[model samples]
Target chain A: MRRRLKSAVVAVPVAFVLASGCQKAAPPPPLASVVVASCAAIPAAPGDPAWDAVPEYVAVLIAQDLVEPRLLRLSTPEIRVRAVSDGSRMAFRLAWTDDTRDDLPGPAEFVDACAVQMPRVIEATVPAPQMGETGRPVDIVFWNAAWQATVDGRGDSIRDIHPYAAVDHYPFEAASLQPGSAPQQEMATRYAPARAVGNTMAGPRQSPVQDLSAEGPGTLSPVPDGHSTGAGRRTEAGWSVVIVRDLPQALTSQGDSQVAFAVWEGGHEEVGARKMRTAWIPLKLEVKP
Target chain B: MALAYNWQIGRSMSYWYPENRPKRQFAAVFDINKCIACQTCTLACKTTWTSGKGQEYMLWNNVESKPFGCYPLAWDLNLLQQLGAQQWRGKEYAGRTIFEAAEAGERVLGWRPADLDYAYPNVGEDDCTGRVDRGAALRAPHLNWFFYLARICNHCTYPACLASCPRGSIYKRPEDGIVLVDQSRCRGYRECVKACPYKKVFYNALTGTSEKCIACFPKIEQGLQPQCFVNCIGKIRLAGWLSPPERARADNPLDYLVHIRKVALPLLPQLGLEPNVYYIPPVHAPDEFLSQLFGPGVPAAICTYRKGPDDPDLAGLLGLFGSTDRVVPRWRREDDWVAALDEDGSQIVRVPLKEPVYIREAFDAQHQVTRTNCP
Candidate 1:
């Protein structure tokens, strides 16, 4: 069961533990803000043209694998985020440290993934950051390492993974219509049926970073929008990703909105409900003078 | 999960809860000799349930051409290979039952099959072991043999699905031992999928959850048969309450076929899950092959099915096939017909020893007479 923050008590136990005996109580979560520069100011390539104007907010997020928690830990739950929005588009650069690099999901195992969630609400009353509530939807940009590997042309094909495994024959892959055509995979013919069956093969040229929408738990679905874009590169520490989309209509010359974030370390076999997450945080936007 | 000594495997296996047996346990039997792989049962099941978005690849009930066919490609062959070979001494298994197969740190006894493995519904349909050993004489028209083995969730007496689910998301109904995955509670770990040797449990990618055949509880509660049971064109499937091993009934139809006559046996009984679905082995198939699939009941079941016409009691049981849509909990031999009764002694069916001379749907309830004074 997903427990929502009651607006009073949140996960501040770790913070409280560190600052005990000090006169001043634990400090509030750092605010993340950015100045929207001109579109020309942003570079074409990923991890390029560093913007010193964007304030990098290093904030801690409390994560627990409460859903049938076993060996996997919700560790390294901290993210350094910097945001910006040109007159036409919005963007955020996020970085987090993870020990082992997980780039495969296979006959062996899972890939690392990161996502950013926004309430999709332009103006008043922030929706519950726990992926939003009913009637309120959260638009998400999810970047999976496996999809990225496909983009980089580095992922192995199904046959490549299991050499000894024989695929003798697939009726769907057969040419010249056979006698009994079948309860056909009508849509599947468009894509290669052999690889199409698995979940990992998202789609061809279909963004490595997918746009999804969710309203509360179990209400997640891929949003049809292809406008949102993201790019990421793995460093020695972990991963640094840039998620960008059209600027929200609610954003005036200078305004702020709440956004939520989640990350999954696939090497630990984390997926679905097993993830590291953060509550609603402010993301300020401005057209820098 | 709990443990029980399954002497059939000479080891303890994950068993249903203690003292958890309901007033009556639901049992089923499929006469493989009658099935023609028509797929009516599959359609009936698919149309009734499992037609949703993520369920496109799922078949709650499936018919696989044996020897070279399996719905999830090689679900049976793969598991068997993983289990390797085990010796069977007469009636008991001398090797591991998955539970004992697990090494030091592993929690599960079986393997996790990737979703890609379950991609095609019938990977090798009707593909025979060989196109017949042509060198041999054509004296036997049936040479390279293949039989249709209809399968469904067995709703085992001890469900591996129930045991492997960490959050206790899977449960066996005490009323009928119908194994079910709690959709609301399932977090989609697919542990049940891995633990189930039969690969009956399926993971719904869309819902991010797991689902399985429910055994049609609503219909069962209403005294109607499951869709697969009533829709079977071959008239092979029978559903009713089976008596527990300790309280074996000599009169009940299920017990008559299983315990009393010993002509119908549980599929893979040595697996030790004690699958509730029983089968009368194919008569013409290789005894060694049938033995592996149905255990020591192979020769005996084949003998009884082949000479069914000679035995009055066996003939009476055979007459009940495709005759009724209600569950027959208890049955007895009457003067003219074999009377099958429900829990309250209501006559669900009465099949005569011989077909009527004028055949216009012989099981007409309006003209059917009930033995009101039957015990």
Candidate 2:
């Protein structure tokens, strides 16, 4: 009798599961869409009171495992996104939870970062979300925490990082050469080769955000004369950042488009292709009467 | 992926790009038996290239006592452990290379050293293998042994740093086969720093980019040896160009020692980077340990090195090391002397195979004084 009772107990759930399996599985819930609220002016800071009026769109992030040097683990699970546009400019606010704030790049350390990607040209069929497919380009606005710290008056000198470091002197600082002279500049360039070559990443930053374009994975390049502005603030929960860029041409006439997002946690040793990312989500512009 | 011939492994192996050899490869040979661990070469390289603000800890050239010493502590031990069993059959390596043993997503099997790993660059300096007893006396082939190993970027035929760079910023120069990181293009990803099996590539936090030994290309272009090679107090290093085995010319000093006599061997050939720098195995170290560190060529190399005195040609070639600051592309042994030749076959420098010796007369009649230290 006990055996029969046990069999009956197991058979009931099994039959129900089998009956449910026989029918077609329900489709997954649709991803959350973002609506860009029209504003008179775009706010440059994440903590601005003007951002409170915009609705939040929660984006679920997955591991970026599509290419070589992949992020097999997801450090950040999701992020809260908000967007605002004022005819000529667009600004996005992204907030996420993280316990450790990493902004310094040491020998073995990486910085926390985030980027927003959008298709350069809106077509009938959207480009592949893996940094966009070949022939179809994507515009990316990247913000780095270390760059933010630099913009906020944090020094990048070796002595600034290593307080106890002692050096006799750099050749560029020699008294023989006049300050800001051609010879002094040449000597300074010898020490900092990247800056001498005009590598934008190695130069002093005027803004924390960078404008980049990509055709596929590992093809990220800086867009010449790109003007983007951004600011980030640390809250009790984690990081909140605001990235401002030129409004896309498609959003003006199409009223609807797609956007993607990526986040990196410095404490997790994430950099380059190792990050948590989200696929394209529907974006709509609220039409004004 | 394409298969490239690695003579060290004695077989074609998988590489990221196809086989594209340079016009001529930069190569060097370090004679280990003569090294005195003076660290002069280290200082020479440091003061010349790595003295900048961001490169304080970077040693483009370093001399570490082997069996315990390593720059990024345990660099070889960690890679060997992860690579598992490395076997060999005669001259061919019967093992998987770093590229072959890579995981699904990675291009090479490697580990990134922590920041602290570089803190103690000379941790096990002068430490011997076996313990010395209370009354242990030194004898021939003494059990407790240690050798100083001087290292720099190998400028490998197939550089792991070049293969693993996602930005394609690190490149091997086609003219001289010297690998370098393009400063402007690097994004500080540090993939090269992590992928180099020898742990030679270093990351600069101040510049936010990776740097490594450029083999002193400016000097090389002028036909002068690198600072480290020229400044070696022990006269243990020789810089020259090396050709592939099929095209190796016996008149070339590097080819004569490496291909003809086989007196020097590449370090850890089983890892299969086909490193350009070769080391003549120490005579006193055990064969098993030496073979593991070098390759199956250790026994034959040691044998040939031991017979160096009897072989005048070999002896003359070794005497040419550290004889000049110029790069010797070709050489010839004429009678009692060896001549280093330039690329145009003109003699640059020459050294006698044996130093001229003189014994002072026990009694100098003219001075009327006796010599107390007569030989």
Candidate 3:
């Protein structure tokens, strides 16, 4: 029920509360201006991709508990993605729908994924840059269809394809690479674990000897909780390695800067669990007004 | 009114001890259907209780959408699967039952990684420090069949936080059944943080004390809803006093809380924390879809509800509709673990379910069907 309060009635009660509830009139406190950073100042790194293709067709892999793998174009169908990272925790929500909610039971059930499908291609405004900073944290939420396709104990089903998107962008420090956009095969491989998880339909089952080192500059550290550790450092090649429990806490800056590590209650165990990682690029601190 | 005056007359009264308790119980009915994912509840909690330093990541009131949701990132299912379907009948949260004790060969009461910051590292901060946004995307869908679980301290009937705390910093108030983390008395040993399966207890590095959702005692004491509820844009929440101990249903898990739709449920009752927060099943999705969101045995669980003609199981079907109803069901909702064993000696209530029978609507609209309570 929407209750639109009349101005007169609302004003009377609000005024009364202010007038009677005030124990004493207090002076206003000094104001503090939070410094705003510029996204333009931090340009993208070299060898960045240009938007030559207006609607770049990219294939993303989707993963869930257990289901077969498939690829969906990100362009034609709407690509929906969500990333949740509350410092200690991080995850991506991804979904999409076809021109018709044909497979949908109804609008409510149809609006979301209830069956397995392929990865989706989305038309996005990805900027050209080797890598640039956004002046804020960027949540990288990836949804793999396979992850969703897997069935639950109650045999609940989900759409096959997965989508990942960033919530917000912080500062991005791109690693220098040979001039070329990420190849379709390489991009697909990056999402191999998600594909595996969905294909197998086994929840959070990572191979014991899983090698998560290829994802980025990081080593997985096991927290007091059983979840895997997502702490690591980058080498000169920009490759990341997991931070061992016995590793020295402080790091020495390499070519650009040294990566520091902090752990929290969030962690995961899976071959693809290492896919979730947030990187901090090193920039020489310069004094500015 | 009389109880208020009586408490005022004796300001120093203590109700923490299990004995000498009243006959009332406290429960929370979370209309998963009404959760809008505004995060106003999450942030309201941050500003009120967890805004302190080191507690930055601690979301005492976190809302996670099912199917692909994870707080510390797929924490529970990952470990639970690893533990291989081994159910913890009593106080133990599912997973490897024994945690490593710093004292050699001496098993500590309860400790797990989900409670501490050292478990999950912030690769975003480490990689980009000031510039690292982790490049991760976080979103909550609207108008879809997603459920919003705004979690705080459950203030359990028998708190794991209280039992596991070596220093005894965590205590459940007898007066209103609100659980609190007494900062002044805490040593940051973090025993309570680990013991709590829900992972509500947190260690604030800046304050060097264990912190958690206080159940908003200050607001509760004033007869008002917590900040999260008052400021919730969706109006998907309801706040009220629960039944005190003696008045609670004999051996009925839901007797202590409000809004147990004979079919309403708790997540992973097998872990045995006796969580006070309860949920109404979202049945709009297919039975299979409902199971994934709720967990493995959801379909069978939903079938236990009795339905009548024209009843869409509105109370049972929450979360997905984006409507947070504060409605309570007529029949006493049962706890999932009521039939299981209680290992650690934590008191567990046993409420048996009627034969699994699903109540359907007399007229089935394409959008909804009636809920049937199992008789």
Candidates in order, TM-scores: namely 0.61, 0.90, 0.38
Model 3 per-residue lDDT tens digits across residues A1-289: 2345567767898899988898576744421211111122111111122211111111232322121010111212222222222222221222333333211111011111211111011112221111112321111211122222221111111112111212221111124333335653343323222222232212232311111111111111111223322221112322121111111111111111111111111112111211121122221111122
Please write out the lDDT profile of model 2 over residues B209-315, one tens digit for every residue.
88899999999999999999999989999999998988889899999999988898999888879999999999998898899889999999999999989999999
Per-prediction DockQ? 0.05, 0.46, 0.01
Which residue segments of model 3 deviate by more than 4 Å?
A1-289, B1-23, B87-147, B244-260, B284-375
TM-score of 2: 0.90
Q: Which wins on DockQ, candidate 1 or candidate 3? A: 1
B164-224 in candidate 1: lDDT tens per residue?
Answer: 6765778888777888887645645676777788889886543446778888988999987
lDDT of each: 0.70, 0.88, 0.36
Which lDDT value does model 1 have at A14?
51
Q: What is the TM-score of chain A alone in each candidate?
A: 0.73, 0.87, 0.20
Docking class of 2: acceptable
Q: Which stretches of candidate 2 lie over 4 Å from their true place?
A: A1-31, A166-169, A174-182, B129-131, B134-142, B358-375
Question: In angstroms, how far off is B1's CA in candidate 2?
Answer: 3.1
Fraction of native contacts (fnat) of each candidate: 0.02, 0.51, 0.00
Candidate number of the best DockQ: 2
